[model samples]
Target: MTDRDAGTAEASARPGPGTDPDPLLRIEGLRKSYGDEEVLRGVDMALDRQDVEVIIGPSGSGKSTLLRCVNRLTEFRGGDVFLDGESVLAMDENDLRRRVGMVFQDINLFAHLTARENVTLGLRRVLGMDREAADDRAMAHLKRVGLAPQSESYPAELSGGQKQRVGIARALAMDPDLLLFDEPTSALDPELVGEVLGVMSDLADGGMTMLVVTHEMGFARRAATTLTFLDEGRIVERGPPDRLFEAPERDRTAEFLRRLTDLSEDRDR
Candidate 1:
């Protein structure tokens, strides 16, 4: 059974805030530092099942760090992260990663591997699936992301958007309960950004739980259930997408959104 199946009972039964049970993801008093500089300061957040949570912030604001922490790509100094009512620190790294998949800003595909091979590698090596089983699963996920035709192509043969889509397919093949996107489109050219965003929007619509750090206000406005503004490693504002865009509770949030909007407009024009 998938790790997601193992956690179903706990996820549905654990009590927490609101009328619902505990969220699918919960981070409390999270703190992280690099050398003498602290990157995340007592950060706290939660994401319920099927919730599309978008985080926006200026560069160096600890957005990526938070994603890294969630999957234990980087360890935090304080606070705890819980997934399906189980502490992240207590879970095996492999097990935690299986339940929480990540798509990074960099499309880190193997240059020598075909798109299908790249997607199947994890399944074969980590999940212990045979070549045929792995290939079948990989192709299914590739089709889901609209990349089944490019399955035989190597990373060098694919465009930026296609490579990122492969990354998404690879993540999805794991059957993760939650997906984390760290600036997934930031590295793509403006013309190529839409395709990747379209796939992500589709995932959100299909009830895939996602935590995304992105500058794409359009996607945030259209797909996000909650919009969080992070600045200097702290959550300055968070609310429904419409509320944050139309009337942010904090001046900082308003100004940041205005600047981001202006930048997006300038790019379009």
Candidate 2:
């Protein structure tokens, strides 16, 4: 099963301050490789409670692979991924998946299933929730992402924007602690990107702990608490969005950001 199929629920949601202190998710010295070609090399990251971190980089930079490693979708060569103090790499698949959720670039909804059905699958199958309870929570999440009315529609019947919303709804139904997004809007048409990102923006605003790997630099700046850049499986630069995007310290980052932003501006005009 993929990391998208979350089979466990660790901590439902985070309690506010004065309740307790726990990092929603943590990663340490995570490494992954295919044979001798290493993709992720000892990446360490820490997100404060409720903080959203965005990772920006070029294609084949291991950004997607890094997110994949977190949910144990891709078995890494070393290191640990923890959500609410539970070790994902060492836990049972169901247990690890339940706490970690991912939204792919292609919005991998079940083609034959209705939007509501897609969202309810995890809750009913993994969590063993009854149809009524699963649908009740699924519909609420669908509505939260502004897709309640399209609940009965199949993936093919919906627009790219709508399909991705259903993907988000499907992931959220499990009530994961850490949400890993691998370019949620990358496959959509330009016009459809905004609707999907709007949902993401709302999620960030609502305090969902998110770690996103995206080429959508504007979205990174808008929705991230911290921004990270990677190249050839190594983190090159990281900082607050404004500082990182506008005044990247590393020359590689400055060059990459310049090219990326210039292309974005050209496309917009």
Indicate which candidate wins on TM-score. Answer: 1
Flag clash pairs in model 2.
Answer: 8-98
Every model's TM-score: 0.92, 0.90
Query: Among these predicted structures, which one has the highest lDDT?
Result: 1
Cα lDDT tens digits, model 2, 130-238, are 9999989989999999989999999999999899999988888898887889899889998899898889999999988899988787888888887777777777766
lDDT of 1 by residue, 1-269 (tens): 22222223322343432114578888877889999998887677788899999999899989999999999999988999999889999999999998888999998988889999999988998889999999999999999999999999999999999999999999999889999999999999999999999999999999999999999999999999888887777777666789889987678888999999999999999
Clash tally for model 1: 0
lDDT of each: 0.88, 0.80
Name the regions of candidate 2 deviating beyond 4 angstroms: 1-22
